[model samples]
Target chain A: MNREIQLIKRPEAAPSHEHLKVVETEQPEPRQGEALVKLLYVSVDPYMRGRMSDAESYIAPFQLNEPMEGGVVAEVVQSKDDSLNQGDIVTAMLPWREYALVKADSVRKVDPSLGPVTTSLGILGMPGLTAYFGLMDIGQPQKGETLVVSGAAGAVGSTVVQIGKIVGCHVVGIAGSDEKTSYLMNELGVDEVINYKKENMADALANACPDGVDVYFDNVGGDISDRVYPLLNKYARIAQCGAIASYNVPNDQGPRMQMHLIKSSALIKGFTVGDYQTRFNEGFNYLSKWLKEGKLTYEETVQEGFETIPDAFFGLFEGKNIGKQLVKVSEPSSN
Target chain B: MNREIQLIKRPEAAPSHEHLKVVETEQPEPRQGEALVKLLYVSVDPYMRGRMSDAESYIAPFQLNEPMEGGVVAEVVQSKDDSLNQGDIVTAMLPWREYALVKADSVRKVDPSLGPVTTSLGILGMPGLTAYFGLMDIGQPQKGETLVVSGAAGAVGSTVVQIGKIVGCHVVGIAGSDEKTSYLMNELGVDEVINYKKENMADALANACPDGVDVYFDNVGGDISDRVYPLLNKYARIAQCGAIASYNVPNDQGPRMQMHLIKSSALIKGFTVGDYQTRFNEGFNYLSKWLKEGKLTYEETVQEGFETIPDAFFGLFEGKNIGKQLVKVSEPSSN
Candidate 1:
């Protein structure tokens, strides 16, 4: 028997055990051009919360009572396709199951020679690409200009602050805890770090961004964003990447921002990494080059066991993860 | 004696009579390069509200006890310069005085052959240029797309809707009254009109735009904008031209829009006409050609006397004007 986690019910607010259920199922078999793989690491992201609801969005909603799917790193146990050999480690968007069958074309072989295979789900994958294009393309940071990143310790934002620094900007990071703030300051070399949980946001932001904010990489949109808007300099740019603050909270309300936008003549563009599909090679080349030169780094908060997937996902809204949050299901069968 | 209006006080909420005061002063002589001009038509605009306050804005605040100034059509009563002759009608940014000395180069000659001298204060001047750049550059209305214009019966918006129609779009106009709606539909040839005061905006918008909103030229930002945000199609663009609804209302609050933007991958750009000053000639050429070809038209809601300028400015918040609101102080001394 194989274990699988299914979406039992759609969430109206914060997701919990009541919305998801773990069940037993028979082992899946591989057909032509398919490979049977065992889950090694499962990626849990904030955007998946949008798919949990039945609302119309950029991506499709998860089917009720069906296995919830997401980015995963797995090891192939049996292969019918010539492209995938036994014990080959691959990453693909797969369902939450201990054992599953995926078409050979759907999964890409992980090049471990570059770095660890897990980097494909974090720094070297979607989150890194999101940070790259969203910051370089939308934010358009310039030397000596101020760049503010909300959720600075999260998967996408952590990379954004580093890129902002590499581009010679006055980088300011806003995070929830002292540990996160310390990491952003000491490790990431951020110009300033505001512990939002302990500091007054408006006063702290004003103190941090005395020259005024020029580029804002917004991941957590709420009162934090409200404070950042009034500080935007003339011709500022905002890369609206994620809004994890509103994902779990129903009917979130705040001060209207249209006037602020008008006063500053700012521009805000909302996008996902998938929107840059054709330019993946361009982004990958830049990111990998930076990583290889020791100019870029990443971190992961991993929970050990498939049963903790729901808890890991739920912790995202609570600001519990330090970086990329993942569930380590099992070690590779052969390495 | 010459009459001038001064900002005596600033209001925390709605602007009223108490904020302005009328004073009498002596008319002065013109210097060597100066011409003494009498005010004929004074333009009253919504953006003036931002200047009424002492807040740091794109333009300077209205100094207390000093005369308020804006775009005006004036007649040269006496000329000490070679550029002007007696009775020449010109347009310039002038103070609220019946007769004042202006440097010859400060004002431009208004060619009456274009339409009328008053057109300089309406369709042929600032309002017309605002409508042209805000819609064409920011909104980017493509053929066969859905273009929605808020404040559709007002000066900038009225022109925006006509341009949308000219671009072969399914144009939807939102206004406050049946009179305004009928004017937008019949006179401007808008494909659909919504009297936001009478109909439920969300339902009406849904019925009017079956395909979804591709471009939104927002002039009145408040509840109307909230309804339009959720219906934005993929890669939509919004020109944040004005927020008349929130200018007087302090501490305005509404539903957050970050999620809607991310879902649609939309872009919102806020700008003023001054931002496009270098390209004014391009905008002017298009507008003049369109007017000459009868593809564009304009309306003016002119109040009598200079004393009514404050009231005309105040009336904008109440949606009392159908199109360009101006105070006709005096007719042209000649012609």
Candidate 2:
């Protein structure tokens, strides 16, 4: 029997452990063209909070009595298809469970030699792809242009700062703590880091970007985004990734953005990483090359044990993790 | 001597007659390379309200104790330049005064053979250029796409509906009254009309467009825009021309927009007609062809006399005009 966390009830405020129930479930067998993957790591993201509610959204809501779905890195224990085999590591959309039986085509075999299989859930995977495409396609940061990114020490934000630097842009990052700010500047090669908790955001941003912000990759919206609004240059592009500030708020009270948009003639666009799945291979190839060249680096805060999955997911809202927050359910098996 | 209304005090709310004071000034002779033009008509637009306040905006605020400036059709009373002769009809940015001493190069000779010089301020001038470039460049409406335009009987909105019809798109106009709605369907060839005052906006929009809206040309951005927000298709574009609904409101009470942008992967862009000065001639030539072919029609609610300029400006906020609102300041003098 395996312990699985199921959504017992929809959440009104910040989703607590009470909203989820840990119950024992019988392990199932893999069907035809399916693989039984022993879950190793499950990712915690801000977008998952939107799915928890019964409100109308881009994606379907998480059902009341079902396990919540998210990105996970797993090891194949058994396979019914010829393409995948036992002991092959892969990434798939599995729930908060110790094991999952997913369709073979739905899972992609992860190349461990490229980097850690855990990085597949962070820098070399969805978060990495989001940063690459969002910045290049939406933000369109040109050479010598100032690129400002909020939530800059997290998985997606860190990747954006690195990619901006690689493209010859002046990258400025906004992080929560001094440690995260130090990590961003020292390891990520970010041009400047603003400790949003300690420093005055408007002053720091204005000082860091003397010319003007040309591309704003927004992850944590609210007052942080409000401060960055007026500093935007004409024809600036804004990539709206996430609104971590308003995720926990029950009512609809985000930032006042109409006046800002009209004032700057800026382009603010919201997009999901799944929308660019057709360009996944291209993103992976470029990201892999950068990782191999030591131009890209990723970090993860892994909470051990399958029972800790709920705590790991809850930790995201509290800003407990430095980079990508993941729950490691099982250990890798030696071939 | 000519009487001109000069800015007396910066307005806080709806501009009254007290904010402007008529002062009699000496009518000077035409200088070298300049022409003295007797004003005929003056354009009154929502954007002028922004200029009335002593606040920083895209365009410079109207200087206190100085004559206001806007698009005007006039005739040259005297000329010192070879390019312009006496009694030649011209169009220039020199309205709100009886007589204007303008540089010869700054004014364009209006051809009365095409249409009335007043049409230049409505269909063939700023409003026309605003609709042309905003629809083609920003909205990018394709055939069979459903376009929803607010303030349907107003200057820019009316032009947008006609242009959408020219591009073979299903155009839906939302206006304040039944008369304006009738004008849009009967004269402008809009496929559907929704009188926001009489009908429920959401239900009316759902009934008018079954497939959902692709392009939302927003001229009045309050409740009308909020109603169209949910019905937008994926990757829909919103040409945010003016916010006539919130123009009179204080700065602290703007419309909410952050959640709307995130839910629909919509693009809301703000633009000024002056930004497209380089492409002005191109837009003028195309709109002129459309006008000559009878594919487009325009209505002007002309308020007679220069003294009625304040009344005409205030009439815009009340939605009193049918199409473009113009104040006739003087009579046209034939050479």
Candidate 3:
């Protein structure tokens, strides 16, 4: 029996496990050019929260009574395609389920020797690509410039800090807690860390970055972003990666940043990894090399069961995730 | 006796004539490398409204009990400088006074034979440069792309529409009234016009731009900007030039647009002409050629008398100006 978490209804606030129900169904058959993937791990991100609500968003909302979908690292249980074979490790977008049958071409083979398959769902996957393109293309951080990132302890934000450091920028991170702040400053080599919870964010930011910020990589938008707005130098670049702060809120009380933007003569752009499909291979190769050299390190807050997916997702909203949040569904298969 | 309007106190709302007092000052002498200019036309823009408040902004706030200063087209009555001669037409940053003395280098000579001296303050001056750079550099309208401009009958907005048309884009305009709408569509050759006062902006935008908006030249940034946000196509660009709608309001409340931006993969950039000073000569030469060739037309709502400077400045907030608003302090010099 294959157990799948079906979305029973749309959510109003932080979605709970009650909003989802585990249902059992007969295993699906793989037709020609298709393969069956037994899920190992599933990635949970703040953007997924947007998909749960039935609203106009970047990606379509998860339909009611349908299994929620996202990036998954799986192993092929059965194959009917020429390219893929049974027992081949692969990555696909088949989420919140124990097993899924999808088009073989839709799945990419993952080399187990490269790193952990779960890393493909984190550092080598969508979040990594998001950080790569957003920083390089949108933020356009120059060497010796000050790069400030909000939500700096999370997956995308942490990645941005490391990348900014690698590119020779003076990186300042703003995270929710002191532990995350220390990790960013000590482990990630970020020049400074502002504990937004305990400190005056604006004053700390101004003090840390005496020369105004050159690149602002935003993940949690609100007062933190509002505080960063006025300190941006002329021609400063802002990459609007995510608004984790406002994602769960039902009303429109986000920060008013228009005046600050105008006064600074800055550029604020919204970007997604999907937009850089043509350059994905380049980014992946670069990040993979950086990972192997130990120049990059990623942290994961792994939840133990498929049942904990909703809880793990909600953890993101409460700033519970230390880094990348993932749900381990099954043990890895040794081929 | 020389009369000038002096800033009496910082204002909280629409600056009434009482905020300014017409006072007599001694006729000033021209220092070395200076020229005495009899003021002809003084320019009034929305940005000046921001200057009236003693708050942190892009430029310094107007000083209390000081003469109000802005772009003025004048005639040099005396010269103590090598660069300028007596009886030369020039444009300078001068007070709202009948006469003034300024360094010769502080003023640029305007050839009335090229176009009207008033044109120096209108199409061939700051407004022209604003439209040129804001549209071309930031908005980047492509041929056949739909360019929608708010405040389309006003100075900067009208120039944006005309320049959009020149760049081979289909231009749609939004104005405050039917007469302004007609002027944009009929006289300015804007492809379509919406009277924002009567029409449902979203419905009108949908009807006018069936293919979706490719570029938005936003001047009035409140409900009109909010209405245009949903109409933007993939990779749309917004040049946030002004927010006249919220300039006078004690508090501004608008819909949060961060999510909408991510959905469209759009860019919103706020800029000033000063930011593009490196390219000013390029923009000036291009606009000057266009103005002389009859490719561009600019209108002015001239409020006669120096005391009307306050009223002329306030007119921008009420959407009363047809084009660039100017204060006529004295008659034009024929010599």
Candidate 4:
């Protein structure tokens, strides 16, 4: 028997049990050039929030009454293709089910020796590459420049903060809670962390970046992004990665930035990891090297069991995740 | 004898007669490494409006109770350096005075055989360089791509519109009046012209750019820029040259553009011509060649008399000029 979670309805704000339903289904069988896999971990990310709605976006919305799909780590239990073995661990964009019968082309083999298999869904995955290209290719933070990262404690933001520091920039992070701020400062070695929830955000950001912002990695947009507007230096670069705060409705925006952009002679570029799919190997290789050298660290708020996947996804908006948020469906077959 | 205009006070909105004063002064003598020049032509630019105010910008604000200085074509009457001689035509950042005593290093000799000595203040000067680099280096208009230019009849904007047409782009122009629109469509060969003052800007823009805007040369950056924001295509480029629309009082701006940028994966680069000062020789050479071949044509709204310089400057804010607005201080001594 296989248990699967489906999107029963679209959520207006915070997703609840009404929007998602878990169902027991028959175990799926594989055909030629296909494999049957048992999911070991399920990843929940903020971009999934964009896919849950019927709103126009880069990617299509998840269909209601169908199984929802996301980044997943699973072990191949039955194989029809000679390339994949029964005990092989793989990563795939598969449905939130205990077992998945998918074509061999859908799954990618993740090396088990690279920290953990779940790292394939976090540091070595989309979030890591998003930070790498968005910051390096676009932001191009120079030495002694002020680099500010909003959503500083999340998977992508934490990685960006470290990269900014390594490149000799002064890194300031903006996060929702004091705990998240502490994580960024203590573990990530961020120069300054603003607890946007408690502090006067604009003042804190201004005080932190007195020389003005040279590069901004915008993750959580709205007030945080608005506050950074007045502080941009000449030729400043903004890498717009995500707008988690406004992902729900997306209507409320602050004052027009063209005047400020004119005054500073700044640049803003929006991108997705899919934009750099050809360069995935470069980012992933460097990321694995950094993880081994202890230059980067990551945390995951892991929920237990397959049924708790929806709860874990909703917890992302509540800021419950420390870095990456994932659900532990089951232990590795070998372990 | 010398008569010059001085800035008495910074203007709140549109400049008035009270903001500037005319003062008659004695002839200035040149010291060692200096030359005495008799002013012939002076340039009145929109950027000077920012200099009149104390607001912090890329360049220093013009000081009050002093003769306002800008791009001028003058004849050297007295020279203390060996390279300079009597009756030499030169371009310099000289005061508004009828005769200016300036350092020999402060001025460069102009080749009148290139086009016109006044062309050094119009098509071959800062406005020309502004259009050249802003459109080529940043906007990068591709062949068969849709390009929209605001303030399309002004100096820099007109040059950009012509360049867009020359580069095999489907060029659409936006201007404030019917006459300006006619000039763009009929003479400049702009594919479409939207009279912004008469039509619904958003609808007209949408109708003009059926394939969506690939490159936008933004010269008037308030509501005009806002209307074009919605019609941006994926990977659009915005070359922000000026904000003439909000030059007087910058408080009234529309909503922020982060969401729209994210949707289209666009890039907006705000730049001043000063940023490309190093590449001036290359652009000037090409511009001179273009003028000789009659590939580019220019119109100058010449304001006669040195005493009427302030009126020509005010004419910029009121949109009275068709192209480059210039003040004729005097006739060139020999040429």
Fraction of the reference Cα-Cα interface contacts (below 8 Å) that each candidate reproduces = 0.85, 0.34, 0.55, 0.56
Tens-place lDDT per residue, model 3, A92-208, is 887578988878678888987779888888888888889999999999899999999999999888899999999999999999998899989989999999999999987899899
Q: Report, to 2 decimal places, the DockQ of model 3.
A: 0.64
Per-residue lDDT of model 2, residues A1-335, tens digit only = 76677899888889998898887898988888888888888898888988898877678999888898889988889999888899999998888878788777888889889988888998888999999988988999999999999999888999999999999999999998898999999999999999998999889999999988999998887778888988888778998888777777765453345555565677788777877889998998999999999988888888888878888888878777888988878888863
| Per-residue lDDT over B77-177 for candidate 3, one digit per residue giving the tens place of the 0 to 100 score | 88898888888889988888888988866888898787878988888889889999999999999999999999898889999999999999989999999
CAPRI-style grade of the A/B interface in model 2: acceptable
Candidate 4 lDDT over residue span B31-50, tens digit each: 88878889888998998887
Model 2: how far residue B193 lies from native, Å: 2.4
How far in Å is the alpha carbon of B195 misplaced in model 4?
1.9
User: Between which residue pairs do clashes occur in model 4?
Assistant: none
Sliding window of 10 residues with minimal summed lDDT for model 2 chain B: B251-260
By DockQ, the better pick of 2 and 4 is 4
Report the number of the highest-TM-score candidate.
Answer: 1
Ranking by TM-score: 1, 3, 2, 4
User: On residues A54-139, what C-alpha lDDT tens digit does candidate 4 reach at each position?
Assistant: 86667789999889999999999999998899899999899998999877788899897887888999888888888899999999
Q: Assess each prediction's global lDDT (C-alpha) against the native.
A: 0.93, 0.85, 0.86, 0.87
Worst window of 10 by summed lDDT in candidate 4 chain A: A248-257
**Comparison by TM-score, 1 against 4, better one:** 1
Give the Cα error of residue A287 in candidate 1, in Å.
Answer: 0.6
* TM-score of candidate 3 to 2 decimals: 0.97
Runs of candidate 1 with Cα error greater than 4 angstroms are none
Model 2, B1-335: lDDT tens digits are: 89888888877777788888888888878888988889988998888887888664677889889988889888888888889988898888874789889887798888987898888898998999999988888899999999999988999889999999999999999998888999999888899999999999889999999999899888887778878887878788988788777666665443345555666677888778877889999999999999999999999898898788888888888889999999888777762
